[model samples]
Target: MTIQATNLGFPRIGARRELKKATEGYWSGRLEDGELKDIGRELRKRHWSLQAECGLDVIPSNDFSYYDQVLDMIAMLGAIPERFADIGDGKDLTTYFAMARGTDQAPAMEMTKWFDTNYHYIVPEFCHDQHFSLSSSKAIDEFLEARELGIHTRPVLIGPVSFLLLGKLRDEPCRPLDLLQRLLPVYRELLQRLVAAGADWVQIDEPFLAMDLDESARDAFQQAYDGLAGSGVRLLLATYFEGLRDNRHLACRLPVAGLHLDRIRGNDHLDELAAELHPDQTVSLGVVDGRNIWRSDLDATLELLEQARELLGQRPLQIAPSCSLLHVPVDLSLERHLDDELAAMLAFGRQKLEEISALARALNGQGDQARSTFEDSRRTLHARSSSDRIHNTAVAQRLAAVGPDDVVRDSSYPVRRKVQQAHLNLPGFPTTTIGSLPQTMEVRRTRAAWRRGDIDDATYRSFIERQIDHAIEFQERIGLDVLVHGEFERNDMVEYFGEKLEGFAFTDNGWVQSYGSRCVKPPIIFGDVRRPEAMTTQWLRYAQSCTRRPVKAMLTGPVTMLQWSFVRDDQPRSDTCQQIALALRDEVADLESAGARAIQVDEPALREGLPLRRADHDDYLDWATCSFRLATSVAGNSTQIHTHMCYSEFNDIMPAIAALDADVISIEASRSAMELLDAFVDFDYPNEIGPGIWDIHSPRVPSSEAMTRLLERAASVIDRDRLWVNPDCGLKTRDWPEVEQALTHLVAAARTMRESTSQRHSA
Candidate 1:
């Protein structure tokens, strides 16, 4: 076997979040343009060097991004939307960031989760008369840049077909796929340049292949690769985040020199691939998991490869991590504080790359030479299963005792709706802010000081109290029906809950990119989860003390916590989630006792946690929704239950979402406007719905008239009594001015609609 090693993609944010800081600094005018680009260049050079040092045969270039790769592709193709293009052709990074973040005058383009991952992508907008041109040479430039460093790298591109399919039709009379031929020329030109620049191979990612493709998408894949067939560049057609499954025949027929399969995610399809793969083409077998933090079982991976070798021979094999390391934290070795046992079981991006290299050596007739590394991996795997931290009998007993009644609310939504309406005295179109207010620079500064012990507990508590007081005053002045405590005392929602719970560990410097220049440190759940005490009751009580309106108690849902954290692999994820839910159910009971009539449990990650394959979905949705119901069922019918979902395609999961049984579910709909609402309305969603009226992701404050227009559309589908108004998501990322302006408009819009509805009823 002459197997090689490669990576589909690596994390772009620096191991210590250098890119995040540099990018944010540039946006804030704290750094010059040249300095920002230099930081990006430095990060790329360091990543490429690290991958090369690990003895990988092929490293990926152009995976690095200041904002998003899809957005970069848009700029590269001169497909800049007219809103951002009015400033310039997006030839410079300024226009690029402007398109992503928006200028003071124009709002940024729509951004949503990238294929169910937390990573966000800027949505491309196509007009009816859209045409394409080769505007940027980033792919060629990056390949040449790597070559100059004495390193040969395969440049990665978002495949032409997937790119068009990923886009939404905005001003177009037709879908984006209608312009495939026009877009093909730009890709062809880029490929020709890469081939001219001494590139032998290029990785064109077609992740959309994993989705249920219609005939048109399948045909476009054939046309695209067939169009670029004559180009001298050898193509590695990559698919990850899921398996080809039904699309395996299409994969074999695509005219590419190579095929990459995610063995971790697509383990079931390996036999089919072994039978269908063409003898002439090479296959890159992704044996390690790039999306997780667990160490790979090298012996097991090699076993799978040995079988593949029997079918296709070692001459055609290449090893890699499934999908990209973009989802995991960058480096595990940097954590000097991690316990030895925990550290051994964990593998971040850097460690995962080394695992890929080790697997290659063992498979390449050097098993004896790599014996020590293999034994260590075996030990890590064994230690995780046998560790005392893996189980708690009490947790198991509690789970065993959970009856059907434990996973269902006390009453139906219609009954709860009448009880909630009578108890709360809310207006027809209720106005509320989502669970958080802006966490300003001073809030962050004080938090840092408190963590460092520069400020004592008393001091920190007082500081947070002041912040909450201010937030309550602001909400009252703005006339919001329900208010949050601003979440000033907490850091990340999941992280805060994890810190208070047993068997969860915190990282000091584990910053992972949430989006462009935005980062989050997901907690590490290493053992059995149990709450130490009430997580939100104190804050909920404090915020309610200052206001007569119902103070919303905010809690992160079990699925969101489980999905976001580095969970244990020793047990089924649904088991771990149920354990977390049992703990949260206690907290929910506490908050209700503390007089919080409106509790908003944010499950932004539920839709994201769904298994990528639809065949495996029912099993997941069954447990995921059950866990959520278990957490929130403790609340009485008089209390309003609100759950928020962030940017996601929730149409498929509407039934499961309805299963959550939240009295009110506030979803992100501003970007799609009233389009997402059509689903809820069409389904005759039994619960009250808050279709977001403002795009909180963008800093641009929406006008009352614009928000009222969205609410008007919402009312046309949903009953006026059932419609609640709010921003798309939390306001923690926005500044005070932005949040204040946006919420004012949101409140005004709700009030205007309420008056109009009253007029109709009176008439």
Candidate 2:
């Protein structure tokens, strides 16, 4: 049997986040023009060289992006929004970023989770008369760049159908897929250019084939590839993040040279795929998981492939990761601080590439070296399974002890609102910023110094306290009704809680891009999770002491803690989430005990964690909502519980969100102009709601009049008494100046609405 090793994509953020620094520097004008492009070129060159050195038979180019791949595809097809038409050339960084981050003249395109993953993508906006043309030479240029470096590479592009399916139709009466025919010609032109540039293979990623598709969507895929089939380059139709399932027959029958299957997520359908494959086509088996950090079980994987080898005697097969490695860290060996025991069970993008290479060699019957590598993998798997530290008896017992009563609050929303309102004594439109303020350069440098032991603990603590004091004074000066400690003592919300909790591991340079120039190092949950002590109580108490206003205690919610982390696969995710919920439940009780009146458990990932297929939604929502309730049920009725969600579509899961039962739930609504609040309005959502008035993701500050209009619209649907005012999310990603301007307007808008409401009542 002949087998090849390959990669779908690599992390463009770089080993030490070089791309992030360069991109942000360019945005701030700190780096001159073309400097960011230089960094991108360097990252792509380094990534290609690394994959080639790892013995990959096929390396993918054009997988790197200045911001996101979806936006890249949009640019390649000349689908720039009409608002950005007056900017620079269609392919320049200024126009591209203007579309993503928004110009003062227009709002940015909406963004949401990339399928079920935490990574966010800039949503494509298509008009009724949207036109397509070959607007960019990025794919061809990258392919030739790799060729010049002596590495023949396959250029990857999001498939024409999936690209359309992932986008939105703005001011149009037709579905995005209706424009498929217009989109295909540009794709064909790009493919022809690549063919002319000496490209032999192109990986067209159609991940939506794994999603539940209607008949029209299914037909769109066939129509898309059929049009591009005439192009003179070999097309490898790639599907990841799921198995083909019901679409297996259609996917396998597609007129393409090769098909890649995500065996890790959709292993059960492999037998059917083997039966359905065309004689001349190659089948790439995704044996290694690309979304996580766990070491693969080589013995079991090889055995499965051996069975598959027999299923198709001489048909060419390739071994690759299930999806792009962009979701994972760049390199594992760069982590010098991780202990031997934990590091043995982990694999980053570079390590996953090596694993893919080793598997290919072992499958091809190369030599003793391959066998030795398999043996090492087997040992690591054994160590991971048998490690006593993975199973915490006390944590397990506590989770088992959790009953239905533990997930219920003391009273319903009406009763809790009355007590909370009286105790807090706030205004009609309660104004507050989200949990975190900006993490400035000083904050980052101080944290780094503390971590490196260059500064003493006392010095760091004092610095944090002063920052908190500044934040408090700023909020009070702005006339905000509620307040936060600004989260100066913390880093990434999930990572901070992970550090305080047991059974979680950290990486020094495991950064994955969350959005444009924004990255997060998701903690590795390798073992049983339990909080060692009060995670946020000390900070909450100190901040409360410094302010007369009710200082809110911010905690990352249980569901988010699970969804954001690289969790353990050894247990059902629900069980692990329950353990985390219990841990946070303790933290919640401690915060309330410390006299924290308002506690915000931010679950920005709740909707992101929902199963992609509707059939699986019920089971996931049940556990997810139950987990959130379990965490916050410990708060007293007077301790107003708030939860936050951002960059997500909550309309479908409003019931599950209401089930979270937070007294006040805040969500991202500014970008949509209060369209998301229609879900709450339709559901007659009982809890108090805070429809965010500011789009925190952008640097452009909205005028108070604009925010007031949004508030008036929200009050039109939601009861005036139930409305609260806040930003779409935390201000951490924004700068201090924009944050100050934005919050200043947010407060003014709330006051304007209050006065307007009072005038109407008096009349």
Candidate 3:
């Protein structure tokens, strides 16, 4: 039998982010339902045609969605909360979107991080009395739609176990597994519908199995699959992100028709899993990398797949990506501005499909069709691996030379605080903000005009200076102890520096969704990284010159810069991060020399770089921590280095955070109700801490009383003198009105704290 090739999933956001614009336009009443349906149909048709062109034997359908797969599952299981069910007929497109994004009368469901990726999923809220019935058949509909186009497709759905595990407990503490018995009938119904609709294969994604699962969760997985096994549709259970360590035994014993494993991140499990596979079962060997933009080494991947085939001979091995192609951009060929050499070293979603197809063909002994492509890809991979441009001997040596003395400050916090008090003479409860003010539409228009050469440098500079002056004056009026120039000139924290630095290339339309309504175009680092000139000096110097108040010079830290960018695949990530750190070391020194007293290097993505498995996190954190020190350690003792991190769970990384030795560190704690402050209380972190006083994600302005309560809670754990009050994150996404109201309350909250402290001192 011929080995069938398949995709676990494909990109849902259409090329050019058509789905995003169309979805937003539809919600805003700019586009009619018919027009939106036409866009959706067009996108699905294009995706199916691409898969057909790549010669994938089992092309996936039902993967396309307006928002996210988790939202689709909520709709499928008829788990509509009462608040959202009253919008319209549940089948209407308006109701679907309303569930994803709230309308005037209803607030959107809460969104949370999807696994470890930046993409957010609509959290499924379940009541204690939740009942399951098959409400919608999106899988059957998409399968028949593809069949009408003469393509037989495998329908995809989140497995019953994973779906419930990802949902939330609304009314009571009910484990999602409690609803498994009730949820299984709906899955069986859906699979039977797909089987009736002429779908021979269905892909059930159980990625949560890759994580540490308790006994109840594992039993739920087996129980749910046992009920669905007789539904007539062939089952392909898929897992990604990391290897199935403890779950390997359950995975092997499952009664599914096939099992898919990610060979990129989970390569260590290949041999052991191959030995344990059931003789009658089919194994889908995911040989191509899916999460990154680097081109695959076709020769190497083919060799590995062949080895797996020999171990499980005639087990119907299929070649595919390690995960869905949603994380990567659409096509590298669309990037016209990238240099030819670097372009040759990269692959995106469209190109990765071709790689999978070619690998399958070569493994099946139809080698002639893929020979030319294989030779070309191998040569490119070898050239990159051997290129001298990837290595910086001097930077490597400097990283090695970093001793314990370099990471430590000259004195303790008490001595340093006394010295700082003598120099600046600040108030009791210091009030400052994380850098950035609102980036309005007018600012974007001006930036676009400047990029097109419609405006001169002097005109653009004047525009930026005016914004900065307004920000500085407003901060002064609000009585803030520290001021920021308002990062009006930056498009993004990391992209702004990538634009000014050498050896980096950016794309005009390379947008990856960060969260809801937020996207970032990560720059591609190709050659040896170097700072051609100072990046933030001019704007920072101008802002510092305009204000007597201490201005915090903002920079994205080295680890974050490397994490957010499409880094070079030629070298180890640790080495490349050090090169970036060395570059920032110069920028930090320049900021100090240019009359800046405090500098905040933001490392929000630092925690994200931690390994998914506990076994590998320490090594990753060691290099990551070293990289941060290499950047900030160049500054003097009096410079008051500060770093900001948000959306992080710092309980695990608290020790590494203290090791960086920043004089002050700010984190997002207001949303968590200052619970993260317990880490500081537990560790007794000597550095000054800024636990954010308000959540900046929402537009609602918090009251002074609310902010005061939060500060009081922080004061119970942290010493008042070592605390600084600030917002959770930057204000770039907010409007001026909201920003002003929020900071006004923030300053008022600080005054209340100071009054309480004074009363205690008098007593």
Candidate 4:
């Protein structure tokens, strides 16, 4: 038996990002239902045809989504919440989008982090009395749609266990797994429909199995598969992100026909897994890297597959990616602006598909075809691996020269706090904002005009400076201690810097959706990463010159800059991150030299970069935290280094946050009602902290009393003097009126805190 090619998933954002444009247009009343459906059909056809072209033996259907897969699962199981059901059955496209992104009249279900990725999924809400049935048949419909195009495909679904695990109970304590006995019927019905539709194989993804699971959760997995085992379709139980360590015995005992393991991230499990595979079960080895832009080392991958083949002689082997291609960009070939040599060193979603196919062909003895592509890939890899452009000898020497003492300042936190307090003395309780103010429609229009040459550089710069001046003057009037220039000129914190750096390339339309109606166009780092000149010096200097109040020089930290962008595949990520850190190190020195007293390097994506498995988190955090220190450690004792993180649950990563050694950290805590402060209390963290006083996700301005109550909660765990009051995140998404109103109450709350503290001390 030979290895067959398969894909865990492919990019759903159409080649032209037609879905993004169509969804936005439909929401804005610019597109008809017919137009949107046509685009969807075309995207599915293109995706299927491309997979077929890559010679994939098991091409996946039901993976193309207008929004997200988790939402699709909610529709498939007919688990529509009561509020959403009023919009009518799932067939109505308008109602579907309304559920995904609420209308003017209806508030959408809360969207939250999707397993640490920037991509957000609509959280499924289940009431205590919830019942399940097959509500929508999207899986069957998409499978049929692909069959009509003459491509027989295996349908993909988020497994019952993972679906229930990822979802939340609406104001109830019942675990979703508690409903497994009832939910089994809906999944069975969906499977039977696919089986009737002539699907021979079905892929059910249960990624949560890679995480730490209790005995009950493990038992539920076995129980869920027992019902699905007899469904006629051959079941492929896919687990990615990391290997099944503690759960390996349970996985081996499952009744599923095959198991898919991510070898890229879980390479350590290869030998162990080979010895544990059931005699009758098939093995799908995910040797291709999915989350990164790196090119595969074909020789190494082939050898691993070959070893697996030897261990499980007659068992069928399937080659695939470690996870979905949703985390990566589409088509490296679309990058026309990148230099040819650098472009050859990278692989996007489409190229990854080809890698899977090539590996399969090589294993099947079509050695010549495989050899041709392998040699080409190797040539590109070797050339980039040793290229003079990528290696800055001076930078590498500086990294070697760095001592342990370099990461630490001259004095400890106690001494530095005293110096900082005296330098910026103002009030007992201080109020400031996380960098950006707002990116209004006018600012977007001006940037667009300048890009099209409709406006000159001088005109654009003058407009941005005016916005900054207004932001500064407004903050002063509202009695803010520290102020921001509002980041008016930046398209994105990282993209703007990436555009100015030497080793990066930008696309006109490389937009990837970060959350509901918010998209980020991540720049492609195509060569050795180095800042040829200062990326943010001019705007930062200009803003500092205008404000008498201490204006924090903002820079996206090294780890975050790498995490958010399409990084170069030539070097190890740790090495590439260090390159970015050194570049920022120079900029940090410049910011301090230019009379700036504080600098906030935002690493919002740091937690997102952690490996899915608990065992791997420590090593990942080590490099990630080290990169942050390398970026900010250049500052002198008086320069207060601040870092901002948004929408992150920091309880688990508290030690890593503290290790960054920033003078102050402002985190998104208002939504959690200062629940994150519990970690600080338990750990006795000594650094200054800011738990957000108000949630900025909504337009409603929080009352001063509300803000005061939140600050009081923070004060219980953190020292009052060490607390800084701020919003949950940046104000780019909000309007000026909302920003002004929110900060007004924020300032008032700090005033109340100071007065209460004075009375308490006097008493």
Candidate 5:
């Protein structure tokens, strides 16, 4: 039997992010649904062609999503939320995008990092009385459409167990897993339907198997696949992101004809699979690295494949990426401007496919035949080490000299808290904005015009200063205690800082999706990082000049900057992060020297960057927390160091969160109605926290009463002195009107909270 080369999934954003443009156009009423649908079709055809041309076997269909695949699964299963049921039953772009991005009438569901990766999925919402029907046949139609183009592909589906496991059940004692029995028939029917549509193999993703699962979740998996049996379509049970550590035995015993293992992440699981897997089961060995942009070491991968082949003998093994290529950029070939050495070390989706194809060829008795490819991979590995562009002796010497004292404040938290409280003279539950005002279309227009040479630096600076003045005036009118410079002159938090720092390079348009309708062009970090000069000191100084209230010296934390960028793989990630930390240290000192009293260094990506396997998280948190301290430790006790983290459950990382030792931390909690604050309460958190009083992801303007209610709920658990009032995250994605209304109520809510607290104290 020939070894099949397969991809679990591919990027759906198209080569130029045509889907983003089309979707945004449709949302703005500039493009009709017909135009948007046409773009989707063209994008799908192009992607399928690219995969086929790369010589891949078992390509995927139904992985293409206008928003998210899980949301698509939600639509396919007729699991529409109660509020959006009025949109009618169809895979209409209006209803789909509305669910992902909220309308004026309804709030969007929560979005968080999918597994351990940067890609965000709209969290599925399931009620206690959840029911299912096959409301959409886009999956089957897409599978047949690929056949029309002569590419017979496996239709992929998010398995029922994993879907409900990732969902949230509201106002109901029934957990999502309890509804699994009812949810299985929907999948069984979908599998049979795909088979009828001429798909012989269906790839059902159950990545939750890679996570720590309870007994109920494990049992649900058995019940799911058992129910899915006899559906006539051969199932390729796929899991990625990490290993099946404790779930290895359960995975082996599942009654499926084929199983796909992520060899890159769970390389240790081969022996377990060999011992426990049924001999008749086909094994799809995922050897290529999928979550990152680094080129695979083909020489090493070939050796691993040889071992796997010897172990699984005639079980019809297939070659594939460890997971989908959705997390990385679409193609490396699209890049026009990268230093030759870094380019050689990189592999986006297009290059990963080539590597997978080469791996498959080498295993099929073509080792000598792919000599050129192996030589190139080996050469890049050597060249990167010796390349002068990658290392700096001075930077290395500096890191070697850093002692533990460089990462800690001289005073303890209690001493520092007393000094900070006396210096700032702030009231209980002080209110502040999360470092940005709305980046309106006019602001973007001015920026785009400036970049295109329609205007000069003087004109741009003048416009930004005026905008900052307006922001300061608005904050003063709203009675906000701590003000921000509005971040109008910046594009992205990390990218804006990265452009000014040494040892970094950027693309003209290297856009990658952060979520639905939200794309970020992450700056690429190369060589030894350093800050030749301050990134935000001048802006912070200027904004402070406009206000008597202290304007925060806002900056992105070192761990976050490193996590968000396309970092170098030649060295340890911790080492690169340390270099970044040292650079940010210089910037922090500059801001302190520039008369900035409050500095908010945001590390929103901190929790998202933790290892998938809990066993590996300690080493990561050590360096990550150390780096954060290294960046912010230079400030005096009077200089309040504030940091912000957004999304993902922080309950697991609360110890690390406490270790960072920032004077204050603002986290995303309002979207869950402050459910996330229980971790702080349980930990007996010492520092101040702003549990984001309202959800910034939605367009709906929250009322002052709602904000007060959330504050009261948070106050029930947290000491009032320890709670700071803020929004869920930055308001950059919002419009001026929405931001204006939100902040106005936010200030009123803070005042109301303070008054009530004082009244209770007096009584």
Candidate 6:
């Protein structure tokens, strides 16, 4: 059997985030067009060279993107929304970016989490009359570019079926899948072009096969591939993030040259797949963990690969990462600050490639050649399993003591709402931010300086306090009823909490891209989580002192902290989440005791962490919702508890969302034009809700009239009195000028809605 080492995809954001700097510079007009393209070319060439150096035989091309791969596919298939038609043809950067970031004339396309990952993708908008054509030559160009660099790479495409499934209908009475027949010609043409450009194999990623599918979807997949059957290039169909449980026969029987399975997530059907494989087809085993930082347990993984090899005698077998390495940091060696002991247990993108190559050598009967790598993996696994740093008996005992009452609030949401409104009386249509204000260059510089010991504690604290003063003054001046402390003292929502909490470790440069030009260095939860002391109390107290308006104490919720962190796989995720919840519960009690009136625990990742399969949803949601309640249950009825979620499909999880029992919930709505509110409307969500009026993810500043129109749409679905005004998410990514402009419009929209409501009541 021929054995090879391959990669599904690589992180497009460079090790030091060069792409972020270049993209943002280009967006700000600091970099010329040629300069931006030069940077992208340099990064791609460097990435290809790195993979080749690591001994990967089947490197992937066209996996890189300026924004997201899905958006790239949209441009490739000419699926640009009608609003962007006048900008240019779908090929230019102006129209491409306009669809992702929005212009003064059009709002940005809707964006949400890609599957269960924190990586966001620009949602495709499809009209009933959507036309399909080969709009961009990115795939063909990248394949030829790799060939020029002496890398015969496999070009990756988002499979036609999965692409259509990932999109939403712009108008009713039309299905995105119905456009499949029209979309297939574009895929076929792209494959033909790649074949003409000297490509032999193409990896078509159909990740939706891992999710639940109907018969129609299965039919669509058959139709899509059958149309491309004779495109003259070998096709490697890839599925990841899950296993094809029921769709196994469909996937295995597809008319493709090969099939790649995520052996990590869905390994139960491996033997079944081996039994069902056709003689002409190859099987690629995804053995390495692509979404995590932990080193692979190579001994066990080798055993699994050997089992597959035995079942499929003399068949071509490939070893690769379970999915794309885009979810992980680019390099582990750059993290010098992490001590040697802790660092030994981790693997980044480059390290994962080495692991893949080692596995392939072992599978190829060259185990002795890769002996040192195998020995290192064995030692790391042994060290991690036996590490004393992993377990905390005290934390375990505290978690054991948790009871049903711990997850229950003292009163229902209605009772708490009455008490909260009576104690903190405010005007109708109250406006608040989703925690953070802009963390400007000064704030970032001060924090960095303090970390580097260039500035003393007093100086940093004084600077943070001044920034808080400015934020409070701005809110009060803008006539917002509720306020936030701006969170200038914090670096990230998750990392800030993890720094104060025990059982967590951090890396100086373990950055992963969340979305466009946005990178997050997720903290690593290596042991039983425990709060060392009060985390945000001092800052919240100082901010409240500067403002008469009730300042909401913002904390990252337990689920988000656990979801965002690189968690230890030693224990069940639910247990670590519970430990985190208990820690946050203590913080909630302390903040309430410190005279904080309202507390917002942001759980934006709660929905992002939902299990992809429907059968597993209940078990995850139960523990997830329980964890959130366990954190906020300590708050008194008069102490308002709030939560925030963004860029998620809430339609399926509306009941679970209600189970959290937060007094108020704010969600992202502006990008979808308040369409996400339909879930709340259909469920008749009882608690107060702040359907966001401004899309903070985009750089464009919205006008008061636009925000007011969105509020009107929200009011049509939700009660006006129960509604609040807020931005879709935090303003930390945006500049102060746009934030001030956007929130000014937000407050104005609230006032306009309040006046209209009052007039209607008088009438």
Model 1 Cα lDDT, one tens digit per residue, 1-763: 4789899888898888889889989978999999998888888889999999888999999898888999989989888988776786568987998888776688788887787677788888887788788888888888888898889999999999889887887864688898899999889999999999999999999998887888999999999999999888899999998888889999988889999888777754556676776776889988888877888888888888888778775437899999878888888878877888888888888888888888889888777767877888999988888889867889889998999999888889889988998999988888887887888889999999998899999999999999999999999998998888999988899998998999898776677777888888888888899887888888789989998988999999999999888887777999999999999999999999999899998999998888877788999999999999999999999989899997887877898999999999998887777678758655877788898888877767879999999999988888788889988888888998878887888888988997898899899
Q: Tens digits of per-residue lDDT for model 6 on 381-462? A: 8888888888889999999999999999999987888889899997889999999898889889989999999999999898
Worst 10 residues of 4 by lDDT: 102-111
Return the lDDT, model 1, position 730. 88
Best by TM-score: 6
lDDT of each: 0.87, 0.90, 0.83, 0.83, 0.86, 0.91
Off by over 4 Å in 3: 27-29, 32-34, 78-110, 125-136, 167-179, 269-271, 386-388, 421-424, 669-686, 699-722, 756-763
Would you estimate the TM-scores of all the predictions?
Answer: 0.97, 0.98, 0.91, 0.90, 0.96, 0.99
User: After superposition, which runs of candidate 5 have C-alpha atoms over 4 Å from their true positions?
Assistant: 366-372, 449-456
- Residue 395, candidate 6: Cα error in Å is 0.2
lDDT (Cα, 0-100) at 82 in candidate 5: 82
lDDT of 2 by residue, 130-239 (tens): 89999999999999999999989999999988898888897867899999888888898999999999998999999999999999999998888788888998899999
Q: Model 2: residues >4 Å from true position, as ranges?
A: none
Error of 1 at 300 (Å): 1.6
On TM-score, the stronger of 1 and 2 is: 2
Comparing 1 and 4 on lDDT, the stronger one: 1
How are the candidates ranked when ordered by TM-score, highest leading? 6, 2, 1, 5, 3, 4
- Give me the candidate number with maximum lDDT: 6
Superior by TM-score: candidate 3 or candidate 5: 5
Better of 2 and 6 by TM-score: 6
TM-score of 4: 0.90
Task: Tell me the TM-score of model 1.
Answer: 0.97
**Residue pairs with backbone overlap in model 4:** none
For model 3, how does the per-residue alpha-carbon lDDT over 1-763 read when each residue is reduced to its tens digit? Answer: 5777778888867668888888778866899999988898889999999888988988898888777888888888898777877897676776777776665466566555677665667778788889878888787888889889998888899999989988866778667679888889888889888888888889999998888888999899889888898999889999998888888999988899999888877754666776777777888877777778888888877777777777787787877889888777777767877767677888888888888888888877888988877987988888788767666666567766867666455776667667777766778878899899999999999998998899999999999999999999999999999899999999999999998876677886677766544667888887667887899989889998898999989999988998788887666888778778878989999999998888998888878787777778889988888888888887876777889988766777788888777878888887556768768756978778889987777545778998999999889988899889999889998889978988999999999999999999999
lDDT of 4 by residue, 289-406 (tens): 8877768888878888888888777888999999888777778777766667766777788889999999999999987877877987789778877787766677677767877766
Range of the 10 consecutive residues with the lowest summed lDDT in candidate 6: 267-276
